[model samples]
Target: MKFTRAICIALVIVLVSSLDLTSAAVEEEIKVACVQTELIPCFVAAFIGSQPSAECCGKLKEQQSCLCGYIQNPTFGQFIKNSQNVFTASWHLEKMIIHVNLTQDNPMPLEAGRTVDLTYSVNWIPTDITFARRFDVYLDYPFFEHQIHWFSIFNSFMMVIFLTGLVSMILMRTLRNDYAKYAREDDDLESLERDVNEESGWKLVHGDVFRPPRGLVLLSAVVGTGAQLALLVLLVILMAIIGTLYVGRGAIVTTFIVCYALTSFISGYVSGGMYSRSGGKHWIKCMILTASLFPFLCFGIGFILNTIAIFYGSLAAIPFGTMVVVFVIWGFISFPLALLGTVVGRNWSGAPNNPCRVKTIPRPIPEKKWYLTPSVVSLMGGLLPFGSIFIEMYFVFTSFWNYKVYYVYGFMLLVFLILVVVTVCVTIVGTYFLLNAENYHWQWTSFFSAASTAVYVYLYSIYYYYVKTKMFGFFQTSFYFGYTLMFCLGLGILCGAVGFLGSNLFVRRIYRNIKCD
Candidate 1:
């Protein structure tokens, strides 16, 4: 449960993937005119922290063609480094060339031909440096598979398997009353006393089945988030297929925001419809409750994190401009969409069907010892969603790490489909079991079920640490956690929302199906 809370917090953080893009021709075009001066390459020690002189910067910029040659020449081979080993050209000037500062006082009056070492570094001045490197599409790793701290594919699968079994048991055995071996039908009963004796166990909540869930805030929050997420997934897939996504730098973002706006309507519809179905009279309250609650909670945390960063001088804001843009999109675009969704949902064709009609008493609970406990059963129900993504998530994880040239849009769309199906199935199973266990009062159960996949993700991350990543220093470690955090948050929201929606529909369906007396 605490983990779920952590995941919800993770949801609002900003993550922008930055792919390295540099080119060779672009590198070759740059030219600089340096006051050429000869020096002993042997004074390598002095050049270690030396500032780049104007002549060095000028020459490096002008004679960019010779820079690589300078580093490669045996006389100055010592300057070559692992970082400098890259063949790619940086478009940025700093990366193109290195400037060696020459001074009068500590003049390098060295032998005609000395040897030296060279390397790439950023702790240098921003003078005659030119950029090199085009694009990075290396298939390297440790980051993707190794350091992904949460939302492990394995744990997710296990949870799914457990839940699937639980669902099977509930759907097959629980309803059947252990094969109904020791039982008889109501009319087929030997006596009315016998029927009453056995029927005293589990039955549909006549009065409370339709009793509105107590936590309006939680319900609204779940509905709103689910609506937003369902929209997000649908949009991501549609955009991916329509060639709108992956077409440019911000296409995905644009698509996300647009889809999110469009989804406000769904959120309104679902929440309003659910509230209406549950017999709640205040539809306006429900609409406002959800539309405001989740966004506020998410953005509130985002603000807190950003404030901390700002206090520590560590970038605590999402850029004033971005926030303004987000606000405009949410207010102007998304709100109206939500209002329409509410209207549609209120007039929903199916919600009016009355799921929890006060009907005949449901079959009683079995007297036999059940193998599955409610917790185990509910947990098991959540695992299916994870199973759906196990293979696909691995590829996505790898693609990001190895810097692989991933352009398979169709494949991603397929994975997204799989994720949705899995999430829905899991949610349905979980809600069903919870409903059976007579825990309908807890509205957040299904939400936690779906989001629990993050546990497996975290486990895998730990495993990857020992088996994959070799980065041990603070800076590298920071980067590792940073990227993995983004991944966890993204996956968390996805799974959670799926579970929530699935459970909502499942409960409503089951409540409606049983014939009321």
Candidate 2:
């Protein structure tokens, strides 16, 4: 009886092993069938047409287990990882449907007896990855969270500290001596002459420094627009943080448009106050220009891009109804708010409060070294500010160009604050240098200095296009550069306004305590 039982147990073990091998072979065959017959043809046909057919769905349901096995297999993993949800649903016998809509207005016709194929691939193994964290497969964690990124932020913070210290030292030491000399009660002609001779730089141009800059209307408009843009960006960043705007289609853009319309008053107020203080008589023109300058520029670029999109029959083309809605929002809400703000600003803060009286005849600006010239100073002023936000720009470009979602608004906020500080410090220094060269044309110089930061950013975008992205063809290329140009324009204006405002305060403070004839 014991020998008979042992032989029976051995026979049972052999039968079980053979069944396991047979199951493995069946699974392999099923996987091959699923990939070749069910997945490839269905996915390709669905991509080319509107949606998958009933037969395609039935085949996918029948091969659900095989699909999961393929997902687990290293060789076929990439081809089917995205279909995990389908496999899971099918495994549980749940009803799930997927639809693919082709965006082309005029799709090419399929030739008789000809077949089309699509090769879809992904670089991820979802064995241990959760559905929520699936996007991590595409994110470049090493690039974004690298030590160099943190170091860049730290370096920018240090630069702010150093610049503030330098400016403070100038105020305490250098300016103190000048103040004591100018405020002295010495009635002696010789002493006064000596002090006058020593007071060559910056002090000589105090009278002309507060004079209205050339193109005053345009300057006021741009400054106001910049102020609005600054507010718009900050609001958008905050909302994105709170709302996870990246998860929703067109959420960020919708927020931006609404916020821009709401913030139109800022530009008007700033422009109006500056224009009024500068003794501008063309109030109507300034108000109109302030309200329309940026919007028109964007509209022009968008119009061109929209035309191209329509020509190509691409989904990127904006519908006429959407365009009309945007125009309505701008015309009714933005324009009126800007007008109201202008009126309020003119009434409230339009009074001139210059520390030094303007001379009837403009002071003759002496020739300075090339490096000290406004153009050169303007060009160089952007370098440090650009450096401050260089790393942040890489992340931003990647999020937009690549299929990555941007969720790091906290980092963005910090970088934005740093960019503001760095821009102000750099612009103030450039303005000081220009003023010390006996030039009173510091208004536009300060604006241009900060605005030049955008020039460098635009140049960086060019480099990224050629090196970091595989974007090709006329439509994609035109849209890429066009959108970048719009972004850079807004950035330039915002930085320019911040720089001017900071330097204006500095100029006022420095000139306030001095004796001016």
Candidate 3:
């Protein structure tokens, strides 16, 4: 750590010494001016495009000494790695030159409202890559505007607002009805279930609905698998924020794999517990599913993408070295988590079904067509989560594989939070709606709702690839679809799992809140 600090200090000294005289003079007559922004990357990208803008150039020159410092600092590093690798390769720039001495009479060029300081333009040649092309940018106002930023933010936010409103309204209504029925059953505390059974004619789920799924083990496995995926994302994000992994680079992949492998414990635990609650009997299948599915899916997709990347000269084949690491990780790490979850689950007794006294049962199924059918509700269920992501997902797809930088982690985090809310609300509403419709078996409703988003995502990707992307061809198409599907499905499932967890907690809590008789 000390050595790294020393190197940084030395670099700063070099930078300051190199820029002092020229920068001071240029500051007054700015060549490349920088716009103010909270994020460092925004400053850089705008400044780059600002090159043709004399004001921007002046600012860049003035700041040359400090550029290295900015690079060293964590906040600004994201911008450097993210700007301009894709469609706008030949966009105009507004770069600054630090030390160009400007005479008082020879004033630096200025924008309409902004002043230009001393700056110099340098010949920035593009790298010799077969696919990507680049040319020098003219420093102009046109370059300073970052189009994608607004496009994504607007698109993403709108979706969130709509979805959140709709989902929330539906769930709240369901809760109200459930509460009413629950209140009605307040008299018969001891035989609440029996009273409910007597009072109602149409309960969504009958006695068989509560039957312990035959394969307790297999149910546990699915739960575990889903849990592993859940942990993988949380750990990756936390690690990135903690600086253990660089989000800008491909270290995200490694972080995900490691986190996923490690999270087998969470998967096993959650899956087993949920299954037990559902009265599932099979536990061994749960273990196998928990351990095997994730590794196999990841390995298969990674290999496919790697092969496609190889054919296109975009990446080398997955090294045998990586394969060894993968095997080691899966064999040693994940298996234990599954085993541990199973052991814990078996040792731990299941919760009694009657956490809350059943206040009321069902009313006669009035032979009336319902406004919301399970299938329709299930389909609509995905809209909330999908809305939360479509705008951001659109940008992400364009950014990845297309070689663009997405530096808006702050905004992404905001969307993520919003997405979580939307998913839960959707699940709760769907589950409630189904139950109210006399179709009470909604265990899978949580998963299905979130999974619905994946459908929209896949469709959107298809449209973007065919319509928006100009440079990519058939192989890119195939590779794109393959990986995109992986992302959407995984994301869908993750969202669904989150919804399920949240709904389960909600349902249990509500069920526990009231007295039956």
Task: Compare the candidates by lDDT and give the number of the best one.
Answer: 2
* Weakest lDDT window of 10 consecutive positions for candidate 3: 81-90
Q: lDDT of each model, Cα atoms only?
A: 0.51, 0.77, 0.56
Query: What is candidate 3's lDDT per residue for 1-517, written digit by digit as tens?
Result: 3323443333333333234243333332222232232233323423322322444334444343233122222343221212111111211232212111111122223123332232322233343332211111111223222585566557766766775677667546644565566567355666666646544322324432334434445444555566567667656666555563433356777777777777777777777676666656566676677677656776788788787767654434677788898889878987887778766765574764744433244334333245556567667888757766776776677667566554445556666777777777768767665655565445565566766888888888888888877645656667778788788768766776777677667656555544433
TM-score of 3: 0.62
Lowest lDDT sum, 10 consecutive residues, model 1, at: 12-21
TM-score rank, highest first?
A: 2, 3, 1
**Candidate 1: segments with Cα more than 4 A from true spot:** 1-49, 52-207, 281-285, 292-318, 347-378, 435-443, 458-497, 504-515
TM-score of each: 0.59, 0.77, 0.62
Q: Over 4 Å off in model 3, which ranges?
A: 1-219, 244-249, 304-315, 349-371, 471-474, 513-517
The residue pairs in collision within model 2 are none
What's the true lDDT of residue 122 in model 1? 24
**lDDT tens digits, residue span 1-517, model 1:** 3323432222211000011112333222221111122322211112332333445544343333232223322454222311222122222343433322211121122222343332322233444323222222232334433433234444444555665677667656665652253243455646655644654222445334554557754575466656577667766776677764443566676777777776777778777776666666677767776676555655665666566545533322367788788888888977777777776877773444555454344434333335334455446644555556655655665555544544455655655665666676666765654555544443466666777676566556666655665666443454455556655655665577677766666556544444444
Looking at model 1, residue 422 earns an lDDT score of 69
What's the number of clashes in each of the models? 52, 0, 49
